[model samples]
Target: MRRTRAATTAAITLSLLAATACGGGSANGDGGSNSAPKELTYWASNQGPDIAADEATLAPELKKFEERTGIKVKLEVIPWPDLLGRILAATASGQGPDVLNIGNTWSASLQATGALLPWDGRNFDAIGGKDRFVASAIGSSGATGQDPAAVPLYSMSYALYYNKKMFREAGIEKPPATWDEMVTVGQRLSKDGKWALGAEGSNLANNIHQVFVLAKQHGADFFDAAGKPAFDGPATVDAVKQYVDLMAKDRIIAPGNAEYAQNQSLQDFAAGKTAMVLWQSAATSFKTHGMKEGDWGVAPVPVPAGGAPGTGRNTNSMVAGINMAVFRNTDNIDGSLAFVKFMTGDEEQRLLNKAYGSIPPVKAAQTDAAFASEDLTVLRETLSTSAAPLPQVPQESQFETTVGTAVKELFADAAAGRPVTTESVKAELTKAQQQMTS
Candidate 1:
């Protein structure tokens, strides 16, 4: 799930706390209607460059669904910043759409609310069985040893996107494979007015994603096996410091980026102001920004200097993607299931994933030629071999909120020329851990 700006964290936190306290009952009624409805509501995540672009891409497909199934889907493309808050509100008030798209990382958190329709044997059978999806995509769909709260829609993994022309001008032959090499290459590219890398410093989710991967490379886990936060651990502190050092100590990231809550970093790369960017499935977005197909190349995100990309400590990415979920109290359960089946069908999977520049989660659709591009090849390899899922615990959302904000503030200090020592990083992380325990 790509993020743009800071979410309404305070509101979401409060709503989530309330929902958890109440044990998450349905506000509408005891159950859904037995009969299918003629129309359904859907809240789509902003997968394209913007909401308008997503609308343009999905409208025709949705019309086709309506033509074939006689079910009109009322579509609303929700921006990332507002998507979580709106979903939380609806879960609490029982006023959400019939079907919605959720960031896959949030599956466990939302599942705890007891508001989403669980994909048990019956539900799985309705949508072509549970075996139709990729195992990696299925891993992040819900909590451990539980029926999934949602089904994977589009699969994605982070990769290093570099400008081919800039690399040639700088005499760099290939993308960096290790962090040391990245900093060395960055220093060489940081001359003149351009910087080596662009980043969304103030975006909460982006902050979490970067640090989470770095922590993994450092052999750290923010949460212990018992599901308690360990944010101030020695390895975790080192990971956070390393990521912020790209701007503070390495001087590879621009200082102005500390205030960039939106996708200004991507725009900077598109305009040739930055040499590279680490992003999730960004091809379609680049095209929308007027970057030609041959302008950029994709590679695995850099690993630790001596570490290789693989599972556990060498993981290079957090299993990233969007999942489709149904509200349990929706009046049109049958209609919602039909819509999900249509979206996850092989034909729609190929068409939609191709347009969005994402990998198809369906087992069969993934073999389509449209996804065999070099960019997707790298992402698919990373997803299968080096990606790790975020902690699938009920408190996962709180972890993202608290720790993500801590990193955001640390970036602000770095941009202001303050010392970002290991001690300072640990202190901030300690504060974040305290918020969860309190």
Candidate 2:
């Protein structure tokens, strides 16, 4: 749901017209409706291998809901690129789906606009209480100490993935426990044109998440207590420099990696050209690239050498995923709320996240036998014990772009064989910080 850039005019215009024409009325300001609703409109995020696949997976769930509630849902699975613009247009035009999917990172920004209903006591009770969700998942649903504006629907976090065959060949008995150890293992594994680490250098959101994890491990935050941009501090600069050094100084990253995005990195890992990658929801893509379950192993990302002992190894991963919200403008409050509850129910969480290869948000689903696999267990533990939410600021989307672009530029310079020093990273981060505040 975190697309790097804006949408085209045609896409915006077409979606706007559809939203206005169909949804331009009775945005549920009052709790009461003029009449009982027969059906509700739902905007689903693209979570399957394809749109059709998602529809197929959810068809039974929707049918069951209609049968039980006597209210139907008309579902539209929006692609990630168009979702934000469509939601914005709907907000401006007083038109949008009754219930929709939003990336958890956008919760605070959308809440600031007051376009989505806050999950007060009534709504929280409807969806099984706050206790039913993972604490980290609920934490990311809105601003700290405030009523959540959305409910966690799917959960994900970055974990280290290593090729088991490569590890055995290199005589590495276990994955690296710290970043310094990783560098050593990577150096030993790199031989005859094969590198040890692969990353999505051009994936803006992915890069931002990576840098956030690194910065947190080194005791840094992207914003100060006063809410100003704080991307150029000592720890932040060190984090970016170390990430860039994977290619420039360590030389364990693939050459020409600046052009590679998420898919390319996975492809490299699956092809045995790289030994390690940090990823979330990698099972499907890992298979698509011809890797079987037994071929790769998953572990928590390594911490800095001198960080806190037990928890630091996994503490820094951003508690990021997707959430579901109800539009304030919708007249079908009852139907919309009902659908939200149904979607977060035990059955639906398992069905949807299983298809998406993401962890379920519900605590019950986390313990279900469906999620008992080793990789899922590690991810569940990470979410429970270590994951931290992205800073819940209205300027978060801007932070993603500005900081991501700076890191992207660093990657570009490194790919071109320029010397990437800590000072150079600090300068780019300072510029990014300026852009965020301005």
Candidate 3:
């Protein structure tokens, strides 16, 4: 029957919700006792739904939202592969969920369609709004001067995860603190069959971010205060070169990494094939990889050499997770906002993080000793001063593709003994800069 959360919402049929979220008033939407109290339909993505099939399965917080707002919320779990397309289709036809779970990076594109309302204005202030989230994560969710489009549900901060067992066995006294130490130790960790680093040759996004961290280490700003590409600067260029050399020139990375995805890197680390990996807060994959509790440790990304000697880049990093947004045309805009705020609030942040093992975006929850402990504490503290996001434009996803292609091409050239000069990279970034701006 494929009944939807919108259908389960107060006995209202999908047809009605389709009308409400889409801003179209279908006859069914305004008709029938099918609706006791007006309902708000929420479409959450696979990130949460993968752990729990639907909101009904995990509703302590959702129940609270329902109780406090007195508005029935129809929670729909849309698979990630299909999420953007389905939401776009529904919204375009004026028949979508009232609220949705969106990647923070998606804000610029989605907002371009004028499909959402910015939560930053005085129109709503439930969970502290901009102050509620770390700067980097919030910035990515489409910030246009006074109008920021989406609110954060939670964030997935990246950290360096190391195999303590491997480090101990190798007789390395402490985990590497700087890029040089990382490289030296990583080289030592590489054995007859194992690689030193979890990041392999492929995974261009990982490589690019590592370069970004390097750029930051050297005070390379991705964009100027006016928001334009700044990678043409020498510091940024150097960082990119260093990363390429690490894998291609230095040979510290594992073999056959070009074809490997992020998951493959995790598997290598978990299997003890690699000693260290750059991981996101969503390391539930750690346990899934048969890593025992405490088998691995987390640290802020280490800085490689550049800018100033012995100094790494700013600890600030771009946020890499999802945020929540309210559809502009929901039947119950007030009720929907209430739910959005509640989910992004401190209380819900705690539950969601604890349940899902992610970094909570709410500052208050980040301070919760119970939820944030040991190595994880760095997340909260660092988040205060060390968070950033990529450009919040409709073309961001496209931009990633452009940058990733360049990164991969550079790596391919390096691996095959081809020239990877600064001039070549500058030209590529120039083309990208043009594409991004135009």
What's the count of clashing pairs in each model shown?
Answer: 0, 1, 9
- What does candidate 3's lDDT look like per residue over 1-438, in tens digits? 012333221112223333344343333322112232457777887653253534544556667766776776767777544566565565455556677888776677666655565564553465455676766666667856647667767677567788898889889877776788878888888888877776644654555556666677767755677655665778777767777776766777754665565467888888988888876663566776678878988877665444222323555355677788766656665566667777877777887776666777677787776656655665555555565565675555445545655667777777677777888777766676676665
Q: Sort all candidates by TM-score, best to worst.
A: 1, 2, 3
Per-residue alpha-carbon lDDT of candidate 1 for residues 235-323, written as tens digits (9 for 90 to 100): 99999999999999999999889888757788899999999999999999989999999999999999977878898778999999999
For all predicted structures, in order, the TM-scores are 0.94, 0.87, 0.77
Clashes counted in candidate 2 amount to: 1
Top candidate (lDDT): 1
Order of quality (lDDT):
1, 2, 3
Deviation in angstroms for 159 in model 1? 0.5
Better of 2 and 3 by TM-score: 2
Model 3 compared with the native: what TM-score? Answer: 0.77
| Error at 144, model 2, angstroms | 2.1
